[model samples]
Target chain A: MSITQISVFVESRPGHLTRTLEAFAEAGIQVRGFCAGDTGEYGIVRFIVDRPDAAMALLAERGAAARTSEVLCARLDDRPGALARAMVACAQAGINIVYCYSLAATCIALSVKDIASAEAALADADIDLVDQAELARVLAGATL
Target chain B: MGTPMPAPDQIDFSALPIYLPEVECTSRERIRAIQLAKLIEQVGYTYARVPWYRDQMDALGVTPADIRTLDDVRKLPFTDKSALRETFPFGMFAVPMDEIVEMHASSGTTGKPIVVGYTAADMDVWSECIARLAQMAGVTAADRVQMAFGYGMFTGGFGLHYGIQRIGGMMIPAGAGNTERHIQMIEDYGTTTLIATPSYAMHICEVGEKLGFDWASSTLERGLFGGEPCPPRLKAEIEARMHITCTDNYGLTEVMGPGVSGECLAHRDQQHIAEDHFLWEVVDPATGEPVAEGEMGELVLTPLDKRGIPVLRYRTHDLTRVTTEPCACGRTLARMQKVRSRCDDMLIIRGTNVFPSQVEDVIGRIDELTPHYRIVVDNEGGLDRMTVEVEIKPEAFSDSFEEMSAFAREVAGKLRNVLLVTPVVRLVEPGGIERTLGKAKHVDDRRR
Candidate 1:
């Protein structure tokens, strides 16, 4: 019920972001979604890529500090309050949302405190969650 | 599965005849004669080949013939790091480029690095010298030596590389970084000896703690540590943590990587200089005059048999004293005290030498970073951790977390590139770091 998310520690500089993107581009890795947070000196560049392992290998080959973690993605109808409902379901289940981001209007990726509880909560709420296979298909440019 | 590790006291190094017993155990008079002859030949070769040496000798009004006795070495002008820097890429090379089969360099205060070359013969001498030091430190053919020093332009890696090979030990050339991999190798390969900077060795211990990898339980018996000084307290702490005795080594890139001197396993107090190949002197840093024996002073060395870039009376800037008293190990080679400090602003972190000015230069290149920065060095579980706290330009201050983190990583990466060491780069608000009047304090060393 989750996809592998690779997070790289990138120094916050002018060319760092550019170089990282260029590295991904050169490796021909497609990024489905990404969210970044900066703490002045460095930034965490997180990516949801088609080939997470390949993307990580490319970053490692480039000597970029990176790591992979599991993040949950839910497929919702293209409408407002869809994320709010999913988040409310997780909040009701006592699953805290660490961070959340969305690429298309219908797909929302969220990192939660408890993966199993969040998945159970989403399942009980009749919300369709994308597994690794569905996420891979989406990352491969397939319509959800 | 692996051989039993030996206790520090149980490691019998004295019983093993010293490497190169003929040279190491030679009489003081005979050693002096060898030094005098090699000094004469090397000085003449330097003056004839290296234009910088010839010009310096001419300016000092001293010729190669002036070096008749070992005392006459004082007549020649002392070569400092500045002299080496001024020569740049290849000016100080006594041998032609073709003859120099290998080259290594260390970071200078500025952008230009101090380049050192080694001929095939020089490489042999380097290996032999390192092998002698290694053997003195109690490494043997049965031991599997894991070298953690980075293998590249830096001399520390290759110095240990050839030396371990000369000793006929199984070498796992595990270059620097990836502490996890190093620990895995130790567990998988049954590594007996570890060669790394004392700081790096400490860092590996920290990694072991995080992964719950018991280094004390590992097959690592002894460590040959150099590239920086290891104090008694630190040495003891490392020995306690890893259950191994660490012998501190001393060397310079200009002289010949890490073969200059090392401590015998029998005595962990002082490093024995390879007197047969290099002549050492402890002198006043200011006056460049020789200090009394056993007195703390700057180290000066002249390569007696070095051919590629023969360094004559080269001031090492490393502050230490030389003692000629016989060691219990039975080697007659003179022992130099452990180096605690330098005569300059250079700082050694995890075996990589770094200068504040070099770091400042890198910071200055970034538009978002202000020139104000403070380097704080701390010893966390015997590992040296450097944190560079710098203020960001007010105009560049961003509320977005992405911008801030991206900037920090960039600075850290650039620093890792130039310094060959990764420092925790912390960005503060403008004017966060204090300003000083006279000589701005760039480094706050809290390791002690």
Candidate 2:
């Protein structure tokens, strides 16, 4: 199962992230989990939001360059080596995890090249996978 | 007799009067005869006055008598910038200091500046040559010409100034920079013609836009651009934005500056050379052999009647094609294509030759990319790597990393198709690259 993630292109400068968050705040879009990476000249900010479609529409209205992509969310054991086990399962199944980040205490989000194979491999490894609806439900209940 | 004539603004530029019709509109045979006689005279004149010329000719065992036909011009020794540097200031002057009336030198960013002295007669010839070029580009005596080219040691400003004076036009003499003042003068004086590099003209348009100055509303109608290569795309942008017809002229300080060849309004693609004053030849940069007809090669020029500082077969290092076919503008002089790049600007990346102009042409063709770019070459692990940093149009930015990555790949693919070597294309933010008022620097080689 996969959930939609929003990636925003921003120039690498002061107040850019703050401005992006302000735009989301003004639009009443709740960002569940977010991470940013830089490439000297510009940065890419990826967000797991409550309403991705609305956020994307808002970003478009603001003339911001952004895109939505599917990412797999996995509910892991609240213990050490939880991510390692999931990574090992994907690696053994020859699934490429493009990027991964922690969403909550025992919930992690991963962007993989082969989402179907990655979801199947994680399910086979006895790990629970979260879809879009389940991820919204968890984010609603969790204090963030 | 019943049909109405077009307004002055709507008149066809091709119908404009040739400044020196006797020479510019002459027969090719007569042009060749004039070139042969001038070449013979120039060779002997240089041999007698300048020791550098005599020594170079003696070493090759070639005498002035050897140059009988125009084809024999190949036998003369080629004078390059290094030769001028060896002679330094005033050493290459064929005339005495009292005869020299004016002097100009290149910016010489690399080392010592190469000086050029113009006698009173030489100044008159320079003015006439520029006037002929100005007329070819549709500059009329009634138009108010504003010069944005700097008027100092650089030849651009003074060359155009003298030419505009000769044409009896109202000269604004605005000089370079102070963009706001230039804009004000253009509006207040109703300037109809602008003398500037294409890049500066583009910059002025941008600044004008920022200041709420409407370029289309302004009286600017013609642009005489030189000092750097103006690609057709950039020229079109300036013309559309400023509502002006942009013309490109070619020149170098080593030869007579800004008077070698210029584009007429009728045939905007090629520039008509002042063949009466200078003999032009296109030869392969490597072997110095003539290229096939209408093929690109290094431009070699020999100033025929220059008395103060005479040069024979001076290698311009600029690469362009030349065609002797008569122009539609009624000029029988040879026409050379706009010089897009120089031989010295060629970069050997990973054993493959690449020119910045090629990269520029590729970038200009893509809709989402801007012409502003920098070619950075660095050696890593004893292997050369070229990175083309291109600015993306603000409207073309995509928030998706995948889409942007694909766009970069597409640009790189196009570049590889042209250059035969793949380069890492980095999409930069709009206005990320620096702009210049003078010649734009395109290469950044860190391998050295």
Candidate 3:
């Protein structure tokens, strides 16, 4: 019902974002979805990667500041307003969306305050939630 | 190359070894002789005028006549910021209000602000001291100096303003803040020298880079950074970013602003103290006993030339060591090392002493982290917990769970290595820490 999202704290400097992505690439960790929220001096880079632990170790080795949080991944039709429909369900369920981004094709990742409630709301609305194992498979370039 | 040699004394270069060559370049023996004379007169005058000093001297069973030699200065009682606070606004003034030409005060963030007054004669000495410091930093009458320190009640702005005016330097009272405008002014006015706190100078560089301003090629040749103790890392960073010769200066409102001591261009490691104007001593803060020469301790100062508020053994609360060794700048005045930290800002966490500046040093060195951070000390259960909330560079952000945790652990380890206490390091967004235009707030203690 929920997918684990890794969020890394990045300073607002040239090549910081590149350094972070390179850390994952060097470790051969494939990221399925990504969203970055910037506040001038720093940005929060959130990722749904195939090998999170390995990616984290590589980033740690390079001395990058990062963290992790949970978000829900829902299967949606590759059509217009699919994201808006999933978001409307979340809003109706009273689950606030911190941020959301597209995951591969026909999948959408939504960060929320309460993952369980968001999952319950989406289930009630007949929206299927992708689990972490499924996310790993999808991020590995497998068609979901 | 074929020009005839000119007489040594005939050249009269505008740049001199000392602003007041007769006093600053005088023999050490003569300097002390002058200090002793000024000390005796100041002691007697304070004892006669200020009731607090008279009571303190009376309690110590020491009279003005007992202060016969420079060593006799130990006989006088120590005056700390608390004494100045107790007296409040005008009680510390030795001379009457009519004689006070200018007044300044500390921030007083905790409680009452410590106020200080200066007479016209005292202002003359202040200007001369600042001029000497300016000349040391390569500022001359021909240059334009932009003062970034705040004006009004705070002393830094007015102190340097008058000092630069005294040296005949074109003064730009830019005050503080408005980074874009400050840079524009520098471009428009050709500001050759800048007077600001070290942190503010670093911030200016950040803004300059963001605005696509070429700060490296700016007219800023010298930076007189003071108001807060500047770490060597910060100084290096400022110099590298701004391409300016940055020198540190020290002063307090309790004493006089900005003119207490400053670094000469030849030697930026230690600051030259204006010994003739103010009698300085290094004493153990705990015992109030004078420490040996070259030993680190709290600074005790007594204004010898100040008439508005002649203080007796006023504790500066700043920690540093003094060396009488002659500087490469050719000035005979004693130089004090850059201030390490303030005793007041020192935090004791679970019996271990920690300075926020130390944490700042560590953060400054880490390229991934910005120097802006907050030290949060809170009481957790039965023990005290220290958490350092530092900003991560926006470019370093990655959504990797393992990466973020590892980064936090590494930062915590680095901090524990220096502080000897394990602190929970919280890495927030790049702009998470609050930025202030004035002195940066490094600590937020909630244990109290």
Candidate 4:
């Protein structure tokens, strides 16, 4: 089972975020990882939730354009150049990084180019990479 | 060889005093004759000074030597509004930027608006011409005049504002907005005459009647109106309701301002184009040749005395005709008929191009639209379809859509005869169309 992150388009307004949160609450969906960003007039809300399909339906009912994008989470060594080697490995395999976010002190998340070949490239590099099935099972098993 | 200079005929030239500048000479003959000499000198000066006019004059084989009289004025090429935009901001001004005292412009193209500068003397010319126009309307030093045109980069405001001061009349430069405040000022200041677009005057009158202000009872005696054309009926209604005589004033920012030509106290619908300071010629719009006497054509004016940005035979695009017939106002300036339409205002539906004025004339006379209407254009299957939306009072909206459709079709039929196109009528509930305080904008072209 692949875990897909849902990104919803929302107009910037007072109480818009609260109203959207209520929609998720009504559907009994717990948002595990969330990113909220404002682009002057509107916000892009991206959520990694327990049930992406049910959450997407709530957004679609409210006339919002929502989409799914593949994302990755990786744990790196605390030492410097540990992530640099991973980047170099991806570069050697002709993989480009679209976006990367700092997950924690020892964990970095990434949205990359070519999910399939890049997944093979990560496996070939002997790097410990968390796949979608593992992330979805962990999210489903979480006590929220 | 210098072509024989034709003497300016004895046409009534005072019909348009606003476009003219004050030369030292007073009479039209002296002014026209002075203009001729200046015309010769200007041809030489511009030919030497300005590069574009030189090229145009050069192409025509017209030199300073060829210009002898007002008749020789034809030797110079006619410039139009597009050329001013081509020149861009102050590129067209003959004088240096330092000499210009003020600048104004209409809406811009692409970015910042296209600008026009007035020399200190240009301001004086503008003001004096308007003052002369006010005097023609029986405005005096004792009379309090209320001006209701919008102020800003718009020319109508400052044009009339300065002219009232130049004419030495007590002027209340009440720029547009706040109709109630305008009425209050009229009452407090004992405003005798008013300057505004005719539709605004009608609106003010309507409001006053509702508020029980008795604007009709007030001493507000006369109105100088333009910006948008006021049909014969609305002109009559405003005059009667506001209890003031209404005079039509016409001009555009492209030429100068609203004081181009104004009706004098004689109540003549025709405005006398001031030929002495500005040479007026009517040309057949299609061929770009001078129309015969009594024939309707586009009015093109050449400023003889305008410095800084003097124009020669600038096409105004206003359709009009000249009659040598005498005006009772006693000014000998030629009488120009009411501007029928601008060449650009004509709209093409399917294949036939139509002007809003054709529908407007009939719409104004009918009690249906009550003077507020909109013209919306859309394209379908490569054909332009126009809908004339009428904002009749809600009481006028019959319960039946069939009756409404029939009513609209009747108006469409009337427009078909005049414009050769059938436009569907859309009967709007009262207050459906927005009332524009400035120019009444009706055309919405959504065609690809």
Candidate 5:
């Protein structure tokens, strides 16, 4: 199963990111993880939030070009090799991960070309596939 | 494409017919003699009937008698927009309002617009001049001319309408805008000649492409463009895209809208002036002295036959060089190079005249935006585009992206109401635009 991520289109300029973050802060929406990348003219800021529906509504009311997409979330053991084992399993299954980021010390969020295949590959390797409900619970106990 | 157009080299310009053989192809001495005689009569007529001209002549210690030779025209005081503004409405009109048959006005820098009134005879002269220019651009009585210029207080629409009528051509008074309808009419009505600004013509081409309409298959054979300067690159692009011959003409409301000078099909680079109707002079902008022949300078004009609002030595502020060398078309009239830039900071976007000060006025009214703004002009998709980047106040920056977008739209709406041209308005963070030390650079023109 996949979790939702919110993405925003912002101009690549000073204070634009600050303004986006300010919107999140004012709404009292806790951000689990975020990533920002730019292409000189404009930038995209993607966020993993606890309340995506509320975040989407807030962004829409603010006149932002914001949208939500599904991505896979996985929980691994606290041991260092746990992530390596999951990555080796996906590699052995020929699953291509588009991008991945650490949500917490033992949790990761990833987007892949074949989400279902990667989810099955991870699950068959005895890796835990986290859904929206499990994600909120795991993030609540994890420290940033 | 229905039929491929003949390459530029294959076209024989010298074979084109002259509309007014007697006047257009007359000897240089004959043209000057005609100009000299008319200049004297117009000077005396304006001096005797118009009080403003009398005062200006009296202050300069000159009379109609002083204008004996063409060289003596320099003694008369130069008239400019300030004089017109000072005498708003009918104050500068040589004839009474009862005799004034028509009136037109152009956008001014601020407040009231500069007005021009035309008597019936003045209308005849205007029509005749435009008729000659239209014929020079190869418009015949058989061609269907579609006039897309706005037919309101502006002079372009009516001026060309009467001119095309004078030629006995089919008139489709398809006034400005409605691009889709314009394209459909061209395909249905078989429009042969298009009259519009060059940018608008390019825009029409774009709309036609999106509609899956083949412009090359259409019957549009030629275009008469005015109201703004058409760069050579833009003209060539329009001709190639629409499969039509594009020609440019120059005029302003103060002097007499369009019909002053136009490009003959024989020579597309320079425009042949209607020398018999208006005396042309190129002078140093700073000193007001005539520049050497064929050298670029500010253009000063004196309408030899304008009876309603006769002006002497009107400073046009447009920069161009004039050449008396005979053209291949055999017309003896002096030809002027294309006007590329202006002495002032006025920006002509699409067909509308835009001044940076007007942008400043729009920005001044908006509380959420700072005074610091940059006006960037560039050509995109063969059309002129103006984007105004305004800095948002820090206090206003806290608003959501949706709010800022709406605020930008509001500013753009207000600007359109004032400028007559819509510009893309962008909201920038505080201090996003670069700061300059002296005389802040407000405009970045990349169109050239």
Candidate 6:
């Protein structure tokens, strides 16, 4: 069974995300990674957390609106055109990549039509496929 | 076993029956009269049990005896959502805790879920009223039913589910989403009735087409679309796709779920309320007086038969035009036109009240954009900042971001003239905005 990295949405308003993160803080659920962008009023703070269930409960108890879905944790080389090659391959594979945003400083998040095909193509091109276990380790305070 | 069958006269339905007929033997005017009488009974019942209600009624010099007829409704106090927030959770339940059977709540998208209860009798009344609704929508005992409403703390799924079973129909509790799965049951199990939100049913039709399933030509004959208003075009769209006569329904979770009012296929303009179980009042938004017949105003509701806890003169915040005229379908119960707009969803942008539905009406008329859009509200200095972000068709893109922004500004300019609200228009790419597994909420109200 493959565990999926979930982007728990946290609001950016005052005390909006405090209790949510506090739940994880108390549960000792370390965040592996996160990316947040704001439209002045609201922010979509997506995160890769180590404790998915605990994190869900923490946010849920606080009534924070969040969704846990099976998102692929794809890894690519931090080099020029590395992202392009993957996008081109996916496009060639008839997979439409809708809304590509940043997951981290190095990694980019793409909501592809076929995550499995995107991963397969990236692997075929010799890119490192970051599994959930690896992401958990990285998010669990492990050095890159 | 057949030889020992008793006569129909031996049947005992004084207890809870699968379907307790609402308002066939009892006339609607009689029901309203009974409702006024019940309102008095409820006030007295609450005065002894519910202190806040007693205090409020007492403060108005309005005792239970003061309420006698429907005209006396003005003497009774009005209740709003703010009062619910003040007394939330269980401040309103009339019966003691052990008597309550179930608890359902409002979405509380803004705040905490305002909880309401169902007594054993409440459970009975809700089902029987909805059973009458299903009968009106053409669902008979032989039909296999598929309900695609979201069930949880919310009430739509459970409300319709109980109604289907009450009408002696075979029920597949296909609680919303998983489109291909619902289609499989519709095909293999031969389900005929579909009860769900209009948008969700349309989504199902889209998926069935993509997956090569035949729900359109299948045995499905009746559809009950509710939770939100469906425009005439979308109503026609769903009907064509499902090959079923799509009927519109109206209700609020606060008003005890989905069977408040429903449109029969004969006409979509007016929906008859279950006046026997619930009382309907259309009050002018400003004056709070009853609107004359065929006039526009806000809808106020009072549950007549409810016992666990009930609201009296509860303002629904839904704006509509009402009429008591006889419909093509022979029911004399008062009917209301589908809501014009939610007063709360009205945006006061640049001195004009811009309703999302008005913008949606325009967008639905235009073929340029997708059905999804967001009104991102922020604080513009001391003023309210309004951003109408619309998704451009994937095939339609400007040469530059500035060009796209200019196009959006032109659209915004048109909207400003139409709605009298100047909005900062931002043209976004297709499919970046959020989508809910449930209700499609477009208004992002900032400043809490």
Per-residue C-alpha lDDT of model 1 across residues B76-102, encoded as one tens digit per residue: 888877887887888888877999999
Better of 1 and 2 by DockQ: 2
Model 4 misses residue B184 by how many Å? 1.5
Q: For model 6, how does the per-residue alpha-carbon lDDT over A47-101 read when each residue is reduced to its tens digit?
A: 6677788777766564444556555555677789887887777777777765455
> How far in Å is the alpha carbon of B54 misplaced in model 2?
0.2
Query: Per-residue lDDT for B1-448 in model 4, tens only?
Result: 1011121243243532332334312455765676677677666766776788888988988788987777777677988777788888777887888998888897775455667788887787678667767766667776788889888888888888888887677878888879889888888888888888887888788877887987646878788786678767778777666767677776667556766676665545687665555668888666677878776678888765667677777888887778766565566576787886786676667766466676777787677566777899998887778888775543354433345557767877877776677777765544546788756788888884
In model 6, the clashing pairs are: A32-A139
Each prediction's number of clashing residue pairs: 22, 2, 21, 12, 2, 1
Candidate with maximal lDDT: 2
lDDT of 5 by residue, B1-448 (tens): 2232355466576665577889999999999999999999999999999999899899889999988999889998999888999999789998879999999998766868999999999999999889988988778888899989989889999999999899899889999999999999998898999999998999999999999988878889889999787867679899888988888888889989999998976567789999999999988776789989987678999999999999999999987789999887678899998776565776778976576766876887788777888999999998999999887664454323445567778999999998889999876645667899645788999987
Candidates in order have lDDT scores of: 0.81, 0.85, 0.80, 0.70, 0.84, 0.70
Model 3 interface RMSD, in angstroms?
A: 7.4
Rate residue B39 of model 2 by lDDT.
87
Question: Stretches of candidate 3 above 4 Å error?
Answer: A1-144, B1-17, B345-448
Which ten-residue region of model 3 chain B has the weakest summed lDDT?
A: B1-10
Model 3 alpha-carbon miss at residue A71, Å: 36
Best candidate, TM-score: 2
Model 3, docking class: incorrect
Better of 1 and 2 by TM-score: 2
What is the alpha-carbon interface RMSD for each candidate? 11.1, 3.7, 7.4, 18.8, 8.1, 11.2
Residue-level lDDT for B220 in candidate 2: 83
Predicted structure with the largest DockQ when compared to the true one: 2
Give the Cα-based TM-score of candidate 1 against the true structure.
Answer: 0.58
Per-residue alpha-carbon lDDT of candidate 5 for residues A12-129, written as tens digits (9 for 90 to 100): 8788888767888888887888777655544557788888999889876766666687888889998869989989989999988767787854778887878899999999999998
Per-residue lDDT tens digits for candidate 6, residues B120-142, read: 99888888767866766667788
